[model samples]
Target: MKICFAVFSFLFFSSTSVFAEESVGISVTATVEGHSYSSGGGGAPVPVPVVSYVSFSGYAYPAAKVYIESDSQNVASLSAGVDGLFSYEVYGITAGVHDFSIYAQDLNGNYSQSVSFFVDVPSSAITNVSNVFVPPTISVDKAEYGIKDEIKFSGYSMPNSSVYVVVNSTDGSLKSFSKEVKSDRNGYFEYAPIANVFNYGAYLVTARTLYGGVFSSFGSSMDFQIMGRTSLFASRPRCSIKSDLNRDCKVNILDFFVELRWYKKPLNKEAKKRFDFNDDGQVDLADFSIMAFYWSR
Candidate 1:
């Protein structure tokens, strides 16, 4: 009986040590659901799928179990095959960024090294998004323009983030373009609209931040318009009187005269814009007349 027990112990140790010198390693990956735009070939990054793989040096089977945990929850369990290979599948994940980890259990219940990876889940909730940003918000500190003129633009975004400004007409015609600007560490960016590209009309202005690996949420947008001087005069606000070039206690024909006086001289762009009330491309009689027509209000 003692001899039989000794032989059994030897056999058990030998089987467990079959691939002891071969070594084993594991890897994992995840697939997110509903995270891609049909227009784009690839889905945005999503929660990584929990996949575990065990590799052996030889044909010996893996004498171990694989385990996976996410957010501290034990989610996967599987036994390695004879060739020391294994895998796990995870599902029913939500949209957003999530972290995952993989682990291995030896025959002696010894836990192996743990590995981690990141995944980003694109939100399908926000539709019609042109692009996503890492630091997803941009602020346009100020935006204003003269009558029949395009708006001046400037803003801030995540540092190193690429910012784009697109202006589209109601008819889907893209006009008045500008190049992307890289933000500084302070998250500041500044850009202007292509002056001659836009005519007097309503437009959609979209500002975005771009990133790689994991896509950010879509950017924010606002509606803006360009109009001739007549429109500005008609809608002149009470506070704008301070900008009266003619000092008429309000902005009117006299301001047009003040601008006309400098027409032949080197033109002051701001003065010309302020007095060129009609925005007829040229600040002449048309602008003066438009200003006169609305001089009182």
Candidate 2:
């Protein structure tokens, strides 16, 4: 690309000599006036309306020949080579703040001043908004009485500023338990609800900007649920030496002798329930046989 630029420059300068018999030469120079934006009339900081300049006699160019451009593709532009004045409106531009520069090239390949403007698009209905990230459904600790349920809430913001979340019940009632969060430099945010509050139930969560005037319409909503905890010991009875159906203290084939001896006796229902190690729910020959099958291993 550099080589192409060099070749193009060489051809362009050589061609200018034919237009002016006095061995003419063309070069580019530009200045972005003030090098920054001004809050016009002290009302509120608006986007710099235009980049203005005066050109010295270098090359006679047609007014319809030059074009003005901005670094950002979305920024608007206009060209007037007649008086070297440029005015443009950056349409659908985002709110909060922005920075951009403007430059133009003459018909004869001479560039004018490059003026950079720092713009504060400010909050308004016409301002553009964007949401860069929407956090995934975060897992909350299953609810156990007296234990806190904690889950993080996060997402990104454009023209990043304060963010708000509305925690709602499954029935669509607005929660008094809502909170606000701030976005990071990279548009990241983290929020953990207070402990001992949320219970096991479905929830609907929605997001919005605190400065809604600028970013109200850019956010989305999500849903999540906190479920009840299951006890590990609830589904099975405690094991014991005598309860070893196979007569192995570790519960193998050796315990089968004791089980066979007391098979007809009044067996503990809990022991019988747990002794169904084969998981068929019947404390019988099959359970004993399975224990014997894996006894040594």
TM-scores for candidates 1 onward, in order: 0.31, 0.29
Candidate 1, residues 24-99, lDDT tens digits: the string is 2222223333334233347654553332221111111143455555554666666655433444445444556655
Pairs that collide in candidate 1 are: 29-49, 30-48, 30-49, 45-120, 46-120, 61-82, 148-227, 148-228, 229-277, 229-278
Worst 10 residues of 2 by lDDT: 130-139
Error of 1 at 3 (Å): 78
- Local error of candidate 1 at 271, Å? 42
User: Candidate 2: lDDT over CA atoms?
Assistant: 0.42
Model 2 residue 202 lDDT? Answer: 57
Model 1 lDDT-worst window of ten: 52-61
lDDT of 2 at 145: 23
True-vs-predicted CA distance for residue 37, candidate 2, Å: 30
How accurate locally is residue 239 in candidate 2, as Cα lDDT from 0 to 100? Answer: 34
Residues 1-297 of candidate 2 have per-residue lDDT tens digits of 999999999899889754532211222233343435568776877666443332222111123122322233424434433432223334444444454433334333323222333444443333222211212111123222222445656554322456666667666553645667775443345577743466665565555444323333223234455545443332212232234554433443356665565443444667556566544545677766655433321
Each prediction's Cα RMSD?
29.6, 31.5
- Model 2 quality (TM-score): 0.29
